[model samples]
Target: MDWRPWLTRWSEEWIGCTAPDELDPDVVRDGWLGFAPASPEAVAAAEERLGTGLPPSYREFLLTTDGWRDAGCFVSRMSDTSTLDWVRDLEPYWQDWEEPDDEEGDAEGGPISRGLLISLEADAGILFLDPGDVDESGEWAAYSLFSWLAEPPTRFPSFIALMESLYAEFHEMRRPEGATRDSWEAQVEEARRHALAGDIDAAEPVLAKAEDFGLSRATVLRAQILLLIGRTYEAEQLLGRLLHPSFTPDGFFADPLFAEEFLPLLFAEHARSSSPGHNSILQSALIGDPPELQLIIAEHQARLRRGAARATYGNPEFDDLVHAALERHATDPDALWRAVGEALPRWRPRSTDHIAPVALLTHPVLADTLTPERGRALLSQPRGDHR
Candidate 1:
């Protein structure tokens, strides 16, 4: 379908785009935006809808605000365990979202399940999303995203205000009596009040209610608030769900903007001295990683064969580790080989997928250890690890 032209009409009529000068509009004929970058509003909405509170970071993300972040599908349609847990608790209302259709229906439908993530692109340099999925009014959502992309706002205040204004209007028209919408506005007010009074606890209740109002982007703001207050686990959980690779485009990852914002703390918060677990996974990400470091390692390795991210593994930030790994591997082939093998488990490493082929091809024991035989063998199975 002519998504661009269609988006133009939709944006003007639904999102209050009176003229082209008010917004930029376009058609994403090719390329993509990293999926599921994370939305503070969505997280908050999800929580309030379920009558539960998300982790402090997630909630704080909602309370906090920003303009543009990474958008588009960077992860697969799969849900991380944490997301699965939250969704298990919220499966009812999300029922409206399309499930992973075993039969890929039309170009417009996009991925199978909902709960998508907004991730970062290694090279595309723009955020993207299914014009149909995220937009409340499919055509309007598409149009609004187009307009924003055409003329990306320079400031967070403008971005937040613009979306808030649009969503507020969208909700009023679509769900006038829905307590969910009313609760969302109330929560925003509540969060504002709590912040003013310095009673963060008081803010929690309203933030909780706001999320119920279908304002998932609030999670982004709330996560910021939680981080400011040092509630890392909850923040991790919310961000984890927000950036999990499973929610993005087929080959996309997490949002670079989100990574830039959280990486400093992410390392200190989740890294383990040793072993490939959650923390490692989150920390090792050159760009898009989950909440923990080890899990980062595990997930990156799982995605090694993706040609698009060939240089991800040996990111400049990670060169030291690679150098160290190279040195250690050179000195102790056995130990190094063991680590390489360890990297091969279920998930792929970001380094291996995007690192220069020469660098990876040069690893003396890489071919021997991460052999196609073994790599294929390990990944060939019908694993439910990420998906």
Candidate 2:
């Protein structure tokens, strides 16, 4: 099938919609959608470098657009003709595969049976054309190779079939509303897919695009990406903004998917930081009466209690007392206060010198519940029965 015309039309539409002038120049440059078709010379050079004839369909794609982005394959960006240096780029991964033991009789001709890497996925997977697996037409079989998989390569009949399948998936993801072609929501969704695929770098540009467009969910997604990459401090800062009063609670926390997937990580990072600002943010997140926020609050407090116990006593079970109280009286302010009151005597001294309870009390949810006198009583109460 001649994919060039369809690919060209799609690429132009995608670039026209998504790559606004306000985006970072570097992002616009690196994004394959914004690139032009490769020169014939460049294509010839790449074929020569790989020492293999280029697949007709992919060669035509290069003529249409030198490289491409967000093709809906595992690959985040397809390589341009000049940059298709599989030998140099994939040699290390190819070498890393171990040779089969001699007793196994080299069933698949051992680790040397590697292919020509055509594109790179975010998780280090490669889409390659295996010369050894070519068809009668001399078209190589395309394989999706992953480092961790012990099974044989995922095979495609030809590069044309692979490109066609990816294009179909990409086309389906497009919305019916033309105005939303470059919408922040679309960008956010793209970033989410990249993040879920462990492609943090690929996700960043799209996230920045979302942020530039002032999408509410962008901050939450950024925090999620940051958390995934171990940038906890940055993640906490972003979450602080996300949970801030100015943003509507439903804007972020109301989504069950976000709440379930990201809230725990946000709360955990805030709890770990022990930052005053984070505690204030946590208080803000819990200030409302929404059932969703309430559940998140309970879970956050429970996590803190458990984390405190682990840090102080090397056993998370110590948090069970506090957990039981919160779980039993979650909806009743007075009853919850009493539960905290009862558990206070047992929890205070051990935790007072610690940061956990101090941080927890700073939040409005617990602050309004505990009076100065009650707090003092709990502090002065003997640790005898509690210990």
Candidate 3:
């Protein structure tokens, strides 16, 4: 970065060490970081490999200077400082970034990811980046930081101590001379950071037992582990109260509600085992908010449409239906299958594999009237084209 004069001054004064006149020229150079956004040249190079231009938004992220986060090695004492994670994906943009002058090739700067990513290894730890040198992808990786050095262990700061230190820091920040409301909020935020980091052992007593503590939120989060292990009985025991009155089912479960596994488990017991109005259950849960589960159901419906030829339909939650559909769709005879995108509640994305296609042949209109070739003709043309 040409802004080195001020950086050197600041680093020297604050870091208590000499700062280089320039960023290591090797940190971001030739476009090597895997999964990183690509520059125009890098994109041109990748086109040679993948055989297509990247999606425009992805391309713009790699080339435009909107400052998105980049992934890289984060070595820093400040656990809360997102610089390390920010730079993990952001380093390429930081170094390769240039401003375009003309459309051809006279650009002064290139694209930046989404944000400026600065990785500060611990306060006392030395930054191990090679300035601007890059791997094949044009950015640095966390592994290179260790591989480049014969002795990288010395650079590995005591992560546990650092975490404990953060806990202590927030403990202090939350309680200044007098405990004001804002201080209480700050304390909870720090606790939340620790909880997200899975510091249950450290956060339990202080967060769960404190008078103005964050027990409710913490409980819902901690219960996630139970949900993950398929111990829904236990998880439900922990979160069941909220389904009734504690955290407001709308807000407490908002996040996990969109998650494929957890959401199903949280409401598995509640969904009607045998019912119809339940179709609208998806509606109410998504009121003001959108229904993401609707996609899962629609996907299942898609699979049913593709799996049947004689209007043969059945349950999905049931195992027999699941196996039958799987086999039928595997050798689907009908060539006319309709792929539709039903509106979802929360827009949760699922893979095509899990979201198996349904059989339109099962629909009476097609099964009762149209033959396979006619169905094929129907499939070839979009409904809008015919209309």
Choose the strongest candidate by lDDT.
2
Q: Pick the candidate with the highest TM-score.
A: 2
User: Scored by CA lDDT, what does every candidate get?
Assistant: 0.37, 0.55, 0.33
Write model 1 residue lDDT over 1-387, tens digit each, in one string.
322332233333332322334332331321121122346566656656545444332233233321122121221122221242322133323223333462166543432122122212212222122223333222212112222234431121222233343445444333334344555766675564444333555555566445433354455445544543445457567655545544222222353323323443344344333265534425434345344544544554465445334232333544445455656776665666455444433222232111111233324354334443443333332221222
In candidate 3, clashing pairs total 58
Please provide, for model 2 over 1-387, each residue's C-alpha lDDT reduced to its tens digit, 9 standing for 90 to 100: 565555555555455556367444654564435367778888889888778778776677777677766665356776777667653355555644534551155344432354566674445566666666667877777766556676555678998877655554443343222333346577777665555444556766777555543454666666544543445467567766666555543545555434444454445445655564545456556665546567767865787678742322112343466567656876776787667656644442221112113323333454456554544434343332223
The predicted structure with the larger TM-score, 1 or 2, is 2
Ranking by lDDT: 2, 1, 3
The order of the candidates by TM-score, greatest first, is 2, 1, 3
TM-score of each candidate?
0.25, 0.37, 0.23
lDDT of 3 by residue, 1-387 (tens): 222232222222222221333233222342222123335676566445433333332334334321221121233222111132333253442333223331234232222222222223333222222213234544332111222344332211222222223333333323222233345455545654444333534443444433223234445444543333234455556554434342343443334222333344333334533265543233344444434444554654575579843322222322244344345544453422221111111112132111111222233332344443443333232211111
lDDT of 1: 0.37
Runs in model 3 deviating more than 4 A are 1-185, 210-215, 226-234, 249-261, 267-387
What is the Cα-based TM-score of model 3?
0.23
